[model samples]
Target chain A: MTGSEGPGHQVQAIGNDEDVVRVRQLVRTAAVAAKLSLVDQTKVVTAASELARNTLVYGGGGEAAVSTVDNGVRRGVRVVFSDSGPGIADIDLALTDGYTSGGGLGLGLSGARRLVDEFELDTVVGAGTTVAVVKWAR
Target chain B: MERVPILKIGSVLLVSIQVDMQDQMALQLQEDLGQRIVDTGCRGVIIDITGLDIVDSFVGRTLSTIASISRVLDAETIVVGMRPAVAITLVELGLSLDGIRTALNVERGLELLARNAEPDTFDDLDLLGDPETTSP
Candidate 1:
């Protein structure tokens, strides 16, 4: 689903590093059109980029969606990153600082969560992982 | 996607780039810089990132790696030119690049690098001579 052609106000892209970049760009563009301040726009875009990367690197690929929220009083973007890779073994440890599974410094998941106003993670060890992040204009 | 050179001033090496550094490119650049630090026998390295408008977690982590590797190699590492917005986003994202050094510009980074360098080598190098010093 494209951002422009939706009742859900959604935009979805395959999980890949490049696709993550695209998603950030889309979020930035939409945030701008929604009249978000430059500061708020960058926050949402950067957060989206981090989550998208996690979806690609850990999830073994997934999809990302962006849309407006809160009746336009504030614009919110939600990204649902799903991956089929080995799921996070320790949720708490993974969220801790300096904890890293891959070569990363373990910032993607935790950092993305911090940047957004709402954050949720649902994962099953062998099944897959899904992360949802939403940020509202302040 | 251009390969930039690592600048050397005395015992310090400086590398600066203006691009949307992300994913593998960021990692590759960090690795290459680490190798250069070892090869050059520099005492410190400074990465001037003034022109970067955005930094993803991958790039942030790669930079942290560069700093860590620099220390292991006995070279100091500094990240400069971090825009306020970028810094705020990074902090809010909970991405802590702790243990990494930072400066405001190449000149300040060079000075800091020089300060961290072997004192004897400080007098012999000129950082502003030419950007060509960084050419691969």
Candidate 2:
């Protein structure tokens, strides 16, 4: 029952610093439009910020899609980050906190996972990674 | 290449980051702040982040790095004007910003620095470059 889409779709390129801020703003706007609370907005926006950075730094740049979803019972905001770059060799290890190949906090994947109600990850080593996250209304 | 203004106030340096910020911009601030520490011979630093709506991991790490660099430069870094939502978000993001001092606002931050400045022997200002060197 996830056919209902709210507002519309937004696509932003994540290749540099400016894009990262843009993606965060985009995600926050969609979350607000979905009527998410201030705290929820901050959480989703923070997740989007992390994922977008990963897409740029780790994934070697990509694109993000922002959309609102209505699952018949709950309204939610979703952002899917796709990038074609050297993918994660071990998803588990990559998700582990403090494990970073780029000297980051390594909280991008796991922390983002915890911030949302639904998370989907797809990656193939030497190929790319796609992360989709959604925060539903409370 | 936007430069975050690092104000030289008496014995303390005040910096207020008001932009949404780019990675390079944050790096630039880090570099400029380090240079300012050496050039101004300040003993303390206070970074105000009230204008920032979000402090992602990148910004969080930058702040931590700034604090670390300042400590090594014979100066202290105190971050102020952190919103409650941003704080929660940082925590949920698994970043504690360890070892960074903070205050409610600029006034409190200045007060903290002022109190610490008394009997402050900033004699070893040369430690601004050498992290291995420590002096009170």
Candidate 3:
């Protein structure tokens, strides 16, 4: 589908494994428009890609949202990736580096959080997971 | 994914990029690879990115930093097997890899290093003086 326009942009896609690439592209476009530096933009996109992949691989399927925020002189982008798969049982253990559930390095959540200016995570044992990431222009 | 072994060849270390070398893993790998090069006392490093379909900014910057870290340890670093699409995308995305050296293939990169090590070929250059002018 096509991404929305204006100060706030949005796009929705399936949580399939292939959608991870599209989410990255979307993050790149939104972050660049928000005036993030190339390195910062890449960081955001990479984090989003990881989260999206996790949502698809572990969570079964999910949705990703992107929006630009302006608070006075401060400007940034916020990405919220939500999924409806088996939720994380231990957030603390999952956040640890090198502890992976999907044959990965278990750096997805922590690494994604590190790349952004702000990070938040919400999950229910039997419900699902939602990860929010925010990166400001610097 | 499985953790691939870091290939060691004499004074050089060669690593094949795995598919999951993204996000935090990418960052950790960068640091680990840099440290390993120093710990091994290798003179050179080659990171083969043949498995990667996309090379984002974080990966690009990490690779560049690894190259610099290798230099700090007196080891040379070379990035090889970057797909044309990935290369073009990195340029389009405005990611600058200033201190990094790239090669089309690992073999060519190794050959380059070998050539640099031995540049003196007797047959390549003629004698400075003519044969008649030389002392008997």
Candidate 4:
């Protein structure tokens, strides 16, 4: 739950490089608050960086939310990135490593998925794309 | 936009990244380093990232690019001071940082560069084993 007690209260805009860094800091704070291990914290922060960049470059600027989640037994840090740019036409191709439309390493989507516990992607060809990822503490 | 400073010591250039580098900042460092390598004619580069919290794909790619650029300029690049947690995360993230050499710290990095730069002093010894070798 996103409350004033934690750092994941605001939905920050991902308009430029600065915003990406801000998103990373927010995710790290939330991850630490969720009591994740140091390695897990690094993984989530790295994943957040990749996704935030994708939201800015491929998605043409968007927003991200960092929050802590609970599913009865486990507590996790969740990050949601949403963009209203040209949505991905081929999800599978985009998810493939080394495949990029913007001349990137093509690790943004695929690699981010590997670093987290749960990954979800929703996109529309002409509308937008939203990616939600969760990294749970063990 | 903050710039990462490049310090020159002897023939090696030391770059200690103390900030959380943005995408543009990373690109700026790559360009600045390329220019510094040419300006100083440095033979080796040691990049310290102990202050970096994460080495995401973007940063990893930038480091790789920097290594290539330095190599083209006849310089060696070694990435040092990587945190253990970051290394674990990078591996799970599937980025091996190809073409980039890494060390545990700056001292070892310098040692690596020194070893690589060492000249072969035993070139004449190879002739001893040749078929043209004659008894003294």
DockQ of each: 0.48, 0.62, 0.07, 0.81
Alpha carbon deviation, residue B11, candidate 1 (Å): 6.2
lDDT at position A84, candidate 4: 96
Order of models, best lDDT first: 4, 2, 1, 3
Model 2 lDDT at residue A30: 92
* Residues forming the 10-long window of minimal summed lDDT in candidate 2 chain A: A1-10
Clashing pairs in 1: A59-A83, A111-B93, B5-B134
Q: Tell me, by DockQ, which candidate is best.
A: 4
What do the candidate models score in CA lDDT, each in turn?
0.73, 0.89, 0.73, 0.91
Task: Look at candidate 1 and tell me the lDDT of residue B50.
Answer: 81
Candidate 2 backbone collisions, by pair: none
Higher-lDDT candidate of 1 and 3: 1
| lDDT, model 4, position B44 | 97
Q: Each model's TM-score, in the order given?
A: 0.77, 0.91, 0.56, 0.91
True contacts kept of 4: 0.89
Q: Which stretches of candidate 1 lie over 4 Å from their true place?
A: A1-12, A84-100, A123-127, B1-12, B39-41, B118-136
Q: Comparing chain B with the reference, what is the TM-score for each candidate?
A: 0.78, 0.86, 0.78, 0.87
- Ranking the candidates on TM-score from highest down gives 4, 2, 1, 3
Pick the winner on DockQ between candidates 1 and 4.
4
After superposing candidate 4, which stretches have Cα over 4 Å from the reference? A1-7, B120-136
2 or 4, greater by lDDT:
4
